[model samples]
Target: MGRSFTVYVAVLAATGSFLFGYDSGVMTDVIESPNFLAYFQTTQTSAIVGAINSTFSGGAVIGSLQGGLTMDRFGRKKTIQMGALICLIGAVLQSAAQNLAMILTGRILAGGAVGLMSMSVPVYQAEVAHPRSRGLIVGLAQQMIGIGFIVSTWIGYGSLHAPETSQLQWRLPLAFQVVPALVLVIGMIFLPESPRYLIEEEQYGEAMRVLRKLHFDGTNDEWIEAEFFEIRRTIEAEKSVAVQGWAPMFTVPQWRTRMLHGVAVQVFTQMTGINVIGYYQTIMYKALGFTGNRNTLVAGLYNCVGPIANFIFVVFLLDRVGRRRPMLFGTLGISLALICEAALNSQNPDGQRIGYSIGGVFFLFAVSVIFSMSFGPCSWVYMAEVMPMQIRGKGNAFAVGVGNWAVSTLWNQVSPIALGQIEWRFYFVFVAWNLCVSFPVIYFLFPETKQKTLEEIDLLFAQRIERIPDEMTQREKEEAGVSAMNVENTKLHN
Candidate 1:
């Protein structure tokens, strides 16, 4: 068991992310269903519709915060199982909803479930992954998200064929969320707990066993021993200074900086206006002159573009290109696309021009393509990898909960009204944010963490360096006949 095993566990854990994507994406088409709106007796821009979207995000905020504690107390694997179970319950309620109250309640529960998994999955992946492939492993969270979006959009598009009054159009998609939730719940039973967590719990034997299975390549016993020694030393050092329960996140200067980076990346990800398009792409398509099933059809096709780009980035570019440059490039590209979309929308305010509609759609796809390659996956990757083990669960939760879900709730609530009343002008808000705020922050503050181990990242942020001990270096040299410089380099690379 080596890289293959790690990938297997990461993929299984990402089913939680898949549920998050499905739950979030399913509503894009659900609210667009004519029967759904008529049955609820509400229009797409209605406050009730906004509440439906906002409530899920609101629940997610609470869930993310709660999940941080849950993962810390019970471990990453159990937290994921708990989230999946909650999602399953929510999916059942949503599929059987008879009124707005019922549906909103279900969405709230589902949102909580997604929030829980969103915080847990990436942290789990980062903890288990070899540093050489951590970006790829952690980035799987976003790739699975893109896949979830694809599946939901296509299902939503297919549901358009149902009889006009059939509630199945939305109900079936809502129900479909249950399948992945069930898969995630069961899959965790076979997965291992994070070795770092085991070490923190003082289960040294179990931790060593896990490290061996995760990193062993038959002739790397010395390397395995060296890594175990480093992890134990770092964790012990952290334990000596670790404050109780979230205080250090705010009180410690280095931890505070880490928190800022985590929250800022997530907040900026939302500010990119990706969800504004994702959660309401059908509505945007409608405003662009698409009618009936055409809205869902175009949305289905549009949803496909992001995942393909994201997959390529995660596998080939993420580690090679690192995090900062891609984020800068992505934000710049998104700004340009948004500008183009705004001009197109402004030119075709009446929604009568085909060329403008085509341009508007093209720019929308451009935004997705750029975002997928840059911020979409990188945000999650950066947030998960940046924190110390002690604060990782709660710190990540705060960032995702406050930065991602809280901001998302605001946007999800206001976007329908904004798009309806202001139209093209709404695009400028994100453009300004991208150029004035997001770009400058990444350029000035963010440091490269690619190809660095979790412990090394700790040193990087703490403004200190922790070299491998001379004794350990000599031991490795004697045991494996590896040079001290070669051993140090391997440690840094991993």
Candidate 2:
């Protein structure tokens, strides 16, 4: 096994992300369905409709917190499987619902499942991937998410062609979510656990074997060995100092700073208004003069743009360009696009001008493209990379749950109502956030972590004590404190 094998495992794990994307994106079409509205007797702006979206996110918040514990206790692979199984159950409830109550329950359950997967999948991918390709590997989370969005939007569009009276118009897309969830559950059985995780469990022999399998390139045994020992030494150092429970995350200054960075990146990611656009772009298109099937069709095309842009960035630019620049530039770009959208929407208040409609749609697509290349993948990568192994599961989950889902829940609940009551004004909120808050925070605070191993990332946040050389006597090793070879390596890499 080599790079290809690592990629294979990463992609398989990303099926969890696909489910996350699909569940989130499918609702855009579901609520738009005339059959769904008629069957449930709810309009798009109804509080019930908002409840449907918000409940899922609310569930995810819970799932994310729980997933952190589960991932740590059961390993990454099993946690994903658990999430998929729960997703299957949620899909069934959603597809067969007879009233709003049932569907909302399903939405909450599905949301929880997504939350669990969201926290687990990226951590697993980051831990397993090679440093040189880590950005590409971890970025797959957002890439798969984009694919999930594309599939959901197209399926939702196609489902609209079904008889208006047929529940299949909404039910079919809801049901289709099970396919990927099922695949993730079964496919994970064959994949290996994270080597970092294995090391934490004191399974050094197994950890070494996994590192070799994941990184072996016919002649990189020396590099692989070095990485294995580096990981083991770092983990040992962390465990020796680690306090039990989640206290250290908040109490320690370095850990607190990392937690803030992780949480802020995710908060900024959601505040960029990607989900608001993804979940309710049909409404935006309607305001832009798209009617009937045109709105859904354009939404499908809009969803397609993100994946292509993200794919290009992940493969060609992510590691090369590094993280900080893309985020800084991406936030600025998203702000500009939202401004254009607001301006164009204001101009086409009646949705009568063809030019304004085109402009509005263009800017919408622009938001998706810029976000895909920048914040969409980078946020997940940053959160996963910043945490040490001792706290990664809980810390990443907390960031994703509190920052991503909690904020997402607020926006998803309010966006439709805001669009109904305030119209184009809501776009400005995100525009202001991007310009005044998100961009500056990223530029001033975030450090570049490109092409560095996970152990090396520790040096960026705090200074480590010097380590004795391997050739030193045991007494000398005890006298020298813990490992600091990575500090010198960090300097050399810089």
Candidate 3:
């Protein structure tokens, strides 16, 4: 296989991301369906609607937390395959639901699968890609995520209008998501395991063979030797670090700090109100008094456009603009846009500004582009890249699961309050959330991981190796318990 082969493989793995987008976005349309209220029997008194909406997030949390262990133990390919199967099952269950519980059950199962994919796909890609092209290749994961959002938004909105032919309306859109999962399962059967994973498992010959395929030039023995050593050194280093399970992560300050960094990034991504727009755009529009299906249609169209724009911006400028500046600049843009949304929404009452509501919707969508191109995809890349490869699965899983479910729960819990009390002012909380947490996380805690090799990054946390301090903060002091040998170990293979 050529470089194209690996790229295509990444594309296939990333296709799982399409399902992630679809499953996540599926509910956006469901909320608007006439059948949705009757199907769930939502009422002012009933908590079922919130339960129905939050259950999937709850399930995703379970899935994401489990995904890291599953990926490490079972290998990325099998874990992904399992996730796909789960997705298919969830789709069938949701499509066949007669009551709220059934639909929620289906969503829970599907959401879990998506949660798993969100963690696994990038881990797999990062493990396989050549160091030189790593950024672009890993970035494809985000690109697919954008595509996934766009696809599901369209499906959710378009299906509402589909002529009633054997339930081609809403059910068809939900069911159709299964096709991608099914294809991923079949395709993954032939897909190779991460070469690094194979090496860690002491399947060196197989690892070498896989590397031969990934490297594209089989004759390059020196490259193979360096790659092989790189894998081996990482495994040896992990042995000293005590990276397994929750114990190592919690006890070691350095480990815990890194984990916290992961959590912070994930939390920041959510606080940006990315999901608020992606999931609840229709409801938000309705709050502005834009009635009928047109609001949903417009919201969906915005999602589709935003991702395309995001893909173009991040894909091209990622190298040129560098990580810190674009993310910081973009965060400022999102905050400003969010403030505008909050202000616009604030004006809706007292009939003070019926004029601003429509403009606010447009502004919210504009904020979507800022998020999609900058924080949206780039955040995932930073998360996967920053964590030490040893506990990457757990770190990523924890961050994503916690972040996603937290947002889902927050939105479900507070959306009603926001709608009921200060509907416009509701977003103000998120604006504050973004400004306070996001900026510092980027400025203080996070490192610029772009264009660096994994081993070089390991040195950032090593004791003896003193790299230049980032303008943001001192090079994080390696914890006391991290012995000389441990530092040596990280330095040896990374």
Enumerate clash totals for all models, in the order shown. Answer: 0, 0, 1
The Cα local distance difference test for each model comes to 0.89, 0.90, 0.72
Write candidate 3's Cα lDDT for 1-494 as tens digits: 64677787788898778787777777777667665555556742135655666777777788888898998899888888989999999999988877766788898898888888888888888888766566667778777777877777677777778643335556777788778988998999988998877866767667767877887565554554556555566666665555457676678766667777777777777888777677667767776777567777777777777768766865577745556666787678998998888777776754335588778777888888888767776777777776776677888898888866667666765565455566677777777877787887698766777666665567665621223222211221121112233323333222
Q: Comparing 2 and 3 by lDDT, which wins?
A: 2
Candidate 2 TM-score over all chains jointly? 0.95
- State every prediction's TM-score relative to the real structure: 0.94, 0.95, 0.88
Ten residues in sequence with the least summed lDDT for candidate 1: 464-473
Stretches off by above 4 angstroms in model 1 are: 463-494
Which residue pairs come into collision in candidate 3? 455-494
Better of 1 and 2 by lDDT: 2
Indicate the residue-level lDDT of 292 in model 2: 89
Q: Which pairs of residues clash in candidate 2, taking residues 3 or more apart in a chain or in different chains?
A: none
